[model samples]
Target: MNEVAVVKNQILDVEISDLINNGMGLVKINGYPIFVKNALPEEKVQIKITEVKKTYALAEVLVIYQTNPYRVTPKCKIYDQCGGCNLQHLSYKYQLMMKTNFVKEALVRIGKLDVKVNDCIGMQDCWKYRNKTQVPFGVRNNKVIAGFYKENTHEIINMDTCEIQDALADEIVNYMKFLAQKYSIPIYNETEHKGNLRHIIIRKAHVTKEYMVTLVTKEDKLKNENKIIDDLVNKFPQIKSIVQNINPQKTNTILGDKQKVLYGDEYIIDYIGDVKFAISSKSFYQVNPIQTKVLYDQVLKYAELTGNETVIDAYCGIGTIGLYLAQKAKAIYGVEIVSDAIKDAKLNAKLNNFNNAHYEVGKAEDIIKKWQKENIKADLIIVDPPRKGCDSSLLDTIKTMKIPHMIYVSCDPATLARDLNILSDTFNIIEVQPVDMFPHTSHVETVVLMSRK
Candidate 1:
């Protein structure tokens, strides 16, 4: 430990010892932990303390005296300023290693379970894997700006291309910005609570090569809408759906309740492992279709369906995982809180002719408790909860039902470990698999298999 006094706005030299869960580099100055962004482990750097706290201090790296061997040059020019991807500076191989360790560490430290965690499933070509793009529209220096938000700020970093998103989506966004400028469209200002255009969201299907363009605006109407639509349709022949989402509120939420089809259909079609799905403007589809298949396939393998088992897919969004498993299971009951998602799930089930599959719109925990009282039983349960992980009530319901097996899909490793700890008494951890759903980000998705003890 160095004898330097730790104070706010003080510049000090430090050695990065480790990386935290959010991809920030960790260094200690005078026996106090300091977190520095854009720094790497095993590197000596000079940092300026931005804030001083009792537990830990936050700092920004000023200079690197020694660099890590695994550090690489990020492809995106705005990678340092954009909040999209954090691990873009780290080598791809090291990113995979860190993610694999993330799962193992969570299981050991939080779950208190010493289990085998397999190496993370990585992409062959990590760039341009995202199938969706949501670019915020704004104005800077009297010019239309559209791109991602700056790190920890609402300011947009105007970008013509993004290494992670599909190239066509970037092109569409640039074109939208160009048209907004050409028509002199007013850009929404959050502070003033005025203007019309807000965001431009683009979605693409890999197998079908179809595209959906959704223009999110502050009002229900758009200026020069017909011309913009005609231009977009003529330029992109693959565009299947063009829609407008009206978000009149002054809040930060992107999509509003009302959506209108400006041209073409209201929804686009896509497939995931032979299961066709109709994706609407508000549908919750995985951004990475390639890794989603890998994640879901692991879920199916862990499910071990025998053609006679009844399974409950909790928090089933659009019935993607449930419909995939419906091929081998006797029956599938999917539960979701979103009514629109439930409707889409039912439509997908009907389209696929999976009469044995059923979907209900309700809180997953409440529905599970109701089913328990009604004497309905499930041989296995698959839960793909949000980053917060499974609710306590749902975990209790799972314990009460004593399902023979469970497949837990989690985006946040810490939450997954916490939930696994809560159910450790009832279930035994069999194995864990970490999937690199977002290649250049600190986030890692994991799938766990647990069997009744």
Candidate 2:
């Protein structure tokens, strides 16, 4: 990577490749794809090349002397540092437009499908939409450090307050510092591989207005466990649940092992629409509640399941969407790969008292095949896969089964486009709706409704 002086370089006018999704502008400078971060299309500005390679150059916004009308001041101080939200600097309406174009670009470039995507479904409040946040702790400057790292770097930027997360979440960080100082629990160190605190994942229930604080660290790290849990429960009665996770490994992953409940309920319960779900620390619940409600409603509306139609919810975690629509359908079968998630889903079904909804613990594709062998037929199927999106085998199974109505919820549009290209022969895309699940970032969640001809 060579250092190129972009500001004073006497180069010709560089034409942007338009918004190539992810809120980045592409330009083939020197026959290489130069990715300019925080850049807008059709807008010319001098950029500072941070890293110049033979193929592409990574740059930062140096002199946007000419600003686009869509650009707005970033509300969060950690806008450029924390990778949590990228589009916050841009206006809400502009954010909506950028996301709308993102989906359109994916369809045109990746899927090669001439599909008409509607305007992105915007949220009521983009900030403070997150109901949960997992703040990581790493050692830096010779002590415990708490904050998010710079984008694409291991360096952590200490933040006094995070605008994207709820104000209570910010307070929790400060409160934990007081307790950590009082209890003398050392924070985790990535370089030296020594420290006590690893992560603090705070879960908030919207309806209940209760909070669940789960402290994750080594099993034997907490010296005075009972006293601390008692102190937390007593001090913060609103803290409905407290959990201690034992994870001794060295990884940046989320889940932990051997959770020991210190106080309050075992799991936190929350509602989405009309259905209630049991949420564990490891459960993959939607981070944004406002947009998730819209996402699920769109799923049900697209399904159009009659009271007599049977619905199958593949990859249903905790049965949030499936259980809500269970009563409308004749029978709802929810399949999940994680057994713990399946257990919680079953409990949620029991909690909702919906005898029509059933949950099975197995891979989405594997369980669907097994159910096919058991002579199971579904009139409607809804799949909300992880970020990597659904695989070919799953799409192939859907095509072979020929499900009449299919609603696919995807967080990654590139993979969604790839899968849609594969399923285009049998199904005509009726409509595609982009949901603003994550408002600040370039990432957008899309729901594609397809009906078989």
- The per-prediction tally of clashing pairs is 0, 2
Candidate 2: 10-residue stretch with minimal lDDT: 3-12
**Every model: Cα RMSD to truth:** 1.8, 2.8
Off by over 4 Å in 1: 1-5
**Which candidate number would show the highest lDDT if scored against the true structure?**
1
TM-score of each: 0.97, 0.93
* Highest-scoring model, TM-score: 1
Give the Å error, residue 110, model 1. 1.4
> Native-vs-model 2 lDDT?
0.79
Cα displacement (angstroms), candidate 1, residue 28, comes to 2.8
TM-score, cand. 1: 0.97
Cα-based lDDT for every prediction: 0.92, 0.79
Give the per-residue lDDT digits (tens) of candidate 2, residues 1-453. Answer: 443434323333454556656667776654557677777766676766667655566766666655667778898877777776767767889888888888888888889999999999988777787889777776555555577878888777776687777778777766776677677788777566677777888888877778889888855558677877777777777788888887787777655667877678888888888788788777878888778889989988887877998888998988888987986889999999888888888889899888988889988888888777787889988888887788778888888886888888888888888888888998999999999888778888999999987
Residue pairs clashing in model 1 are none
